[model samples]
Target: MNLFAEIRALVIQNLEAMQSEGVLPDGLDLGNVTVEPPRDAAHGDMATNAAMVLAKPAGLKPRDIADALAGRLVADDRIVSADVAGPGFLNLRLAPVVWQGVVGDVLAAGTGFGRSDMGQGRKVNVEYVSANPTGPLHVGHTRGAVFGDALASLLDFAGHKVTREYYINDGGAQVDVLARSVYLRYLEAHGQEVAFPDGTYPGDYLIDVGQALKDKVGDTYVGQDEDVWLEDIRNFSTDAMMDLIRSDLKSLGVEMDVFYSEKSLYGTGLIEAAIEDLKSKGLIYEGVLEPPKGKKPEDWEPREQTLFRSTEHGDDVDRPVMKSDGAWTYFAPDIAYHYDKVQRGFDALIDVFGADHGGYVKRMKAAVSALSGGTVPLDIKLCQLVKLYKNGEPFKMSKRAGTFVTLRDVVDQVGPDVTRFVMLTRKNDASLDFDFDKAVEQSRENPVFYVQYAHARVNSVLRKAADAGIDTNATPDLALLDHPAELALAGKLAEWPRLVETAARSNEPHRVAFYLYELAGDFHGLWNKGNDETTLRFIQEDDHAGSVAKIALARAVAIVIAAGLGILGVTPADEMR
Candidate 1:
């Protein structure tokens, strides 16, 4: 029931008719032809660029083509009027019945009304919040978790088979630091005083993990040296930290379909295999790299190292896969991780990384491009920092995470819904300001509340109508819905299918959030109009059939709002009170 699509099809059909009549030349590329809502609603219901795009190709003037196209379009019952705008744009106003049909289609399709098959069941792997298996997830990972989860749902709605993945960086030196930190807490559990040095984690979150270790194996590693206990404690501590991270994510309504272990890439030959794939393409070689642009390391001597010819793809410089000391560089394992994703037969890969990892983006894409032989497309989204405020001042740090706020801290302060919604209010690349004072406020200024109140108001109308003995179960007589206000709401409803396709095509889930807000605003405006004009009210006291038709319109809005919120992992509010 995409009215824009339907209108575009009609335009293409008319163009084909014109070509057959030899009015326009054959073989004009119509790929660039687009039909969308006019910028100014007063101009028309929809506009098409078909005339402008085909004019030069057909060796005809834009206005001439537009005049011919307009004539063919108005012949159809759906199109009430068609006029040529500047140069060659075709602006169209649909018949009133057309808008009524859109509302009816929404009720019939229900929540699946806007679902798109644009992705065509392609497999996509989305990896996010791969926070080191060290301690509780902090505020930084919260943005990525919400963004990735919403994006997975969006892709799924657009018809992509998506897998939500979290890569456990257990093979890194950070996990070893976590192991030693937990060992100190373990000693403290055994009644031994311990001091956390500069590199050790001093957070009290590890205190319970240490006690758990003692409970599992009492006195086994007591007074043991690093060589004897390091490996076992590393595995044990990392598992416990992952459990903490999983709990943190669950509290925020995030669930991962896969948790890939970096350690698995180590013991197995996956790294060798991934590098071998690149080597076969003559992309891997032993070479020396120029020191990084801004800063050179203290040990800055140029030495031969295993490098990937990332420059051939799109990276600014070739990147090192192995250090001079024969140890796998950090980039090597990441390359292997992406290779594993490609081997799993996913048609696309999306990585949600923190802003600091922006420098790592190009090389990572180059690796996936080379490994997948450009068959798999990879997009890396960088979530910027979040600034927290309370009582109009900067929020204090958590004693648990020591230097930053934990995800649990934000969730506990305001429930997951507010946290998730406010987090998405900004673009992933822009810095987000999460205000403790304003987000939970039950006022129109708060977007979360504003949008939820709109949904709740619709529910209120249905409940009141039911109490007033208006037969709410009757099918809406959509033909009676021809008022300007009703038609306006229906026109907004018609944009949902197109919005979903565009948002999913760009891999941008924030567009969903923005669309939901605009829809809510339109709905709220219509509701307010009912206050001054009794006829615009959803419930007509004396007319049961007209009331059912209006209620149907309100219900249709609620249905799409709930579906959009579901995609964002947000629970639709039933009542504001």
Candidate 2:
């Protein structure tokens, strides 16, 4: 159970009682009232702004309301004391039994302890890693993939029905370029000399595709004109490139529920249907966009084009949907894609894009808004660049990927768990530095290792208790867990449910990583404190009941850590090597 929520219910109930007693007016808006952990742990277990928030609204003095509320709150045995802080904010110290019950709650709930129904079963579509099926995914896509996958899992944990999607950019001229590049490789497989001009891909990874094509059709398309092979090879190369991309994602433990193709939206009425929907709303019109702010009138060419009145929905300016030649602009397909998502009946949409696509956020959101008539909310998260370093120097490898580091390159050096956890250690909008040396180090400096070590330590404790014939599964005398360290660790455990709600609400899975680190730190601190204080030791040889009580707390730490790590798609280590 959420202790904070229960206490807040207590506060609200008391406020209602005060209304009946004429201490406060009836029908006061209590929406602004909030109960949370105090800023300073020493202040108390929880703090509420009930008095401060209601004082001005009720036309009453702050201290008078706080005094009345405090006197009523302490009537419950769970609330040991209630003291008014600055400006009539109420700080509350709950009885030790309250913190002790948190351990029991965790042990009882296991990994499901912190799961929330904040989403209320709403259908949320999270689209990420929409990389073009041109080549292997790079480090930039790695961050997006990890962030998106973790977010999807986080939303599911928060009780939303989530769909993980990938939009394939296979409908562009880039695929034609890939076909030509593969043709050159095909010629090479046929023992012919070939030169990869600037526009063609030159990676050796394509060598196998070329050889495979040679095997599929022996000497059929060799020495042919562009028309004979372009169509067939374009389709072939796209399929093969998509296969490579899928492998890249699989290497990092990512799997998409859908692989939507941009080309599929074409050769069909989908784009026209999406535009017609907007047209019916009077949002589509023929217009010319103004020139850029710095451009001279003489140098700028203003062409009349088919445009979408994006500003009506929230874009900075109107956007062109079609060129003067009646060809669809790049935006037409994206609008159709989101329209497709809306047609699928998702209650919300999320797009995880790279930082470079920040400019497109407004337009995409505008398109979705108009398409769904503001019924479906769209959120676009941009992942920033990742800079790799090692031993105080920049580390750049994967010559096959040319100038960039492929996702495979990173995963090959450090396994998928390290790669996934490290990618999430930073906020999606912030640049991240991935140091090879630091990531694999076993010390506490490595967050992945630090968090994993905590889980491992719990396992170690459980094993020791089992060998000593201590029945950890038995109901323990949790009331014996009154030591300050024990209480502090329990306090951290209680924050897990609250944290899950906050992180899910903010759409920030990185917060989970941060919370796990702090929780691990708290557990490790308590473990270390046992070195000096005999009473603080978890395994009390002479008192099996006391030992079981402490082990319950330790087990609860492992449970929460495992749950947090599960959202991040990292395995919790039973024992670290």
Candidate 3:
């Protein structure tokens, strides 16, 4: 299954054998030892730094340990040769059957072949796309939604119990602005025409909310003062906007396990309890912070306020939790929200925030650390902006969101699969350019298209094999799959499990997209290679056993591709349109 792991275990076993036989000293730390794919495939199948890692600690030369280790590794049936390269790296060439066996294992395991247990069932909460319930979700939230959903799926694939959460920003002044905007729309839905003033949402999306409000209550609150309708409309507009947001996310194949409201934290003693918990730890105090770095002294004046001792936990400076006006700052609700998450007993927490919120990461982490006493770790991943391109020009804004492209616009344009795949083509912290022209192209230049085409080609081969009456259900003569090209394809298949473990451990789901692309490239390369060599074709008229062997390898590639796409929330393509 995992040949690399199997070989590494062999290396460790032989090292222990060496120690017990008095060939080496006792109790050396083997934690740093690692076996991975060689940098250049032409050199070997796998390379380990066992010698380099142990040389200094064991008081021995790297070459000496490497040579001794190589001697023992060659005796294993799976290892064809083990040679020391560079100062101490052990380069290994595995037996042909070792790679062949990967195909059999994949067929037996099906699409679950590469699923890993690396997470050990740890509880992780992933909060993402917590955009304020003001209007529709935009392109930036789309990137966060795709990235966070894929990351949660990746963690789940690796054996973590993940909860997808959305924190509603309902307690902020923005919601009040939304209510004011919707009230104007309500007036517009009546006989009177209303103009949207500044500080109010003017997008066309709110017109329907206004119309719906008018439908529910006909002109009762139309002529009322702010006090008569602000609170009621605030609740009404937020619910409507959240319904719109939920529809947008569902369009992109994203769903949240929880939708926590900031309004619930207000006047409910939750914020007080959290701050009190921090106060008990001496983390809260009333103090005046010095002028922030790089700010003109006159630009920022000293003001006495309630501050959190974030500096004690790793923040650059103590952050104020309450303003001089005796009102809680925006950071207070966030701290309380995270405190609630910690009390829920999660092993870890991950927040996917926009890149503009990068400044908030350290302080948020500090709050979680102080509140949880460092028992729970909080990781905030900042997603950079997304730029849309069409016809060699920047795309226009959505009239619905006003000055931004909505998530519904993207999903409607490219469908969820292209939207999700293209969103993850870049790293979360890096800016992404979603080009309408490039995303749907049926060429290798487009990664999603290329990967999907590979899956489709594999399906084509299966259909062809079945039509030829080649007994597609027969067991493959895996040993017959010894051609260099065939074995290379299998070698790529063997990396799937390891890739899943590494990508999940790093919390980078983009790695899954990248790996799927590379696997597709390998599969495509083998498919093209079959054109010139009749023997390399997956379906052979003369040799049914040989055809079965090659079909096995092709099917394995498709299985891995589908599994990888599943983690990305992308549907595998059986045919390209």
Best by lDDT: 2
Query: Of 1 and 2, which scores higher on lDDT?
Result: 2
lDDT of each: 0.92, 0.94, 0.92
Q: For residues 496-565, could you state the per-residue lDDT of candidate 2 as single tens digits?
A: 8888888888899999999999999999999999999878888998899999999999999999999999
Query: Compared with the true structure, what per-residue lDDT tens digits does model 3 show for residues 1-577?
Result: 6777878899999999999998778999988888899989998999999999999988999999999999999999999999999998999999998998999999999988988788899999999999999989999999999999999999999999999999999998999999999999998888788887878889999999999999998889967999999999999999999999999999999999999999999989999999999999999999998876775776677789999999999999999999999999999999999999998989999999999998999999999999999999998999999989988799899977786889988888889999999998888999998899999888899999999999999899889988888777798889999899889889999998998988888899999999899999988888888799888888888898888888888889999999999999999999877
Each model's RMSD to truth, in Å?
1.3, 1.3, 1.2
TM-score for each candidate, following the candidate numbering:
0.98, 0.98, 0.98
Give per-residue CA lDDT, model 1, range 90-205, as digits (tens). 99999989989888888899889989888899999999999998889999899999999999999999999999999999998998899999999999999999999999999999
Candidate 2: stretches off by over 4 Å: 297-299
Question: Candidate 3, which ten residues in sequence have the lowest lDDT sum?
Answer: 291-300
Query: In model 1, which regions exceed 4 Å deviation?
Result: 294-299
